[model samples]
Target: MNGPGPWGPAVDAQGAQDVLVHQALMYGSRHEYLLTAVPYLRAGRRAGDAVVVLVEPPVAAALRGQLGRETAAEIEFLDAAQWSRGPMHALASCHDRARADWWPRGRLRLLAEPVWRGRTPLETREWKRHDALLNVVFAGTPTMIMCAYDTAVLPGHVLDAAARTHPELAGPDGPAAAARYTAPAEFCAECDAGPLPPPPAVAARRSFATGGLPGLRSFLFTEAARLGLPEDRTLPFVLAVNEVATGIIRDGGGRGSLRVWAEAGELICDVADPVRVLADRFLGYEPPGAKGHDAAMWAVRRLCHIVETRSGPQGTQVRMRVRIG
Candidate 1:
């Protein structure tokens, strides 16, 4: 179902009016990237929209060089590397930027590359989830977002998922409706139904009670170090797990299970409890104030490489992973 269009009179696939025009840019080279992006940025500038660009540093540099100092100065730039902090946070930030300063009177135009080379499988998963969640997050806002995926660096599966997540494709030619796009709710459901494989047998497992929180943190640190997770990532990894485990204790019947494993040069942690606390699939993806009781889960999403939640008759489970070495 669609609501009234907020960004003028644009219509979507279901004939529903919407203000958001979420699209993907799959480019195989730097030239192709500029070909599709330059004009898009120029148009936004000409229209006096609040234009923001979040991409890899090199790409940002290239755009700046091409746009020249004045035009480049007009666009706001954010580092895509910090996407590990959470796409929802980035989205909120962009929204806040558009609403602040001189941009409030105009529409929001964003060009973001949330995915990049050297990302772990877990990071890939979470960002893809972010892509699907974007539709729901900005549904009625007067915003246009283009998610760029480097076809030369990203796998075919990644590109395919991009097609599924975005409602349209923006290329050098122009924006067109995406033929394979799945509705936000349906795509999120599909993601929820597919849980990650069980932690490897070699994974260290332990059951923790309220008293074991300290031990749980120690265990995670040891495993993270053993897996050679960089010094910088170690703390966030532990803190993220700590938050989830703390949630399980305070809200999930006062106890939970913890497991840590290393595979594919990444560290994986799983936290589970008998209580089913998250009934809403979009818990972590929603804005902070809107998250209500699921705020801890939202924090976990921001800190970890990937945060996957599943609830069933058995119980609720949260799996978080981060790339080690």
Candidate 2:
């Protein structure tokens, strides 16, 4: 079935629409943006219909802050804890039970049939393929189908048969299904470079530090090559690397300025307090936990430089601005 056209009841169901957002199977780090789900809840309440967000514990906490006690009365938050007990149990126990009841029985019957089948990988894949297309049509909005990192090998026939033929469906990554619900067009156009213009002195300081040291230059070149970042993108990467190294110097048991440089748009680093951050590559250093107050701010400043430097249609460097904040 064709997805609902742009102006359809599902998308226009302001104040009276019953919408179910299925966020199951979403990992925390990758899907942290789901934290924005609370804003959707707030939107639903304002619109006058009930909004249900089904998510795991970590997501629940992040969302609760958005809803808070004051705004939460109208919206419902369902925890996905023990959702793995089984699919049927998950569907029945999800916070949206009442809303699901309002859906037509035939629709419910069709939806429930596949709940069992989703347990198997093959079935889940087929279901997602089916749902990706159907959600757009039925709901008159975009739906994101979470695919594995290795989606390059997906058969052309599979995508051809499932996707809608629309120019608006294009995403930063190409043919984005998630763009349906969230307006990808706006996201693509809006460039909010956070903070202000960075001092030239800071830029010069970084340039000098990187130029004098081969290790720092090599680091930038290596990482730039690794991510295929363009020559221009090196500055941002350098900034990002320095920001990280600086965080280490400030937080770790170090007592010197963190030094950085860029070569061919790759970052190299030398910390005055080296012992803390110069751990064995990859396996040695622990993964950075949730970035804290100062760390987050530093990330924002660095990412803003990246975005400002490379802002344009069809920009090579994917905008990393949002995560910085």
Best TM-score among the predictions, by candidate number: 1
TM-score of each: 0.76, 0.29
lDDT against the true structure, each candidate? 0.77, 0.34
lDDT of 2 at 173: 28
* Pairs of colliding residues, candidate 1: none
Task: Please give, for residues 66-162, the per-residue lDDT of candidate 1 as tens digits.
Answer: 8989999999888887743655556556545665742465777888987456655555666677788888777777678888988877788889999
Give candidate 1 regions above 4 Å deviation. 1-18, 26-36, 61-68, 79-106, 150-154, 210-235, 290-293
The 10 consecutive residues of candidate 2 with the worst lDDT sum are 105-114
Q: For candidate 2, lDDT tens digit of each residue in 1-325?
A: 2224221223324533333222212222424343333333454455444344445655556666666777765444545444433322332233134335523221110111122222443223333333332332223212221221112434444343223222233222222233334232222222222322333332222222322444555655565555556666556655655554444445544333333334333233333333342211111111123422233332433343222222223221112221111
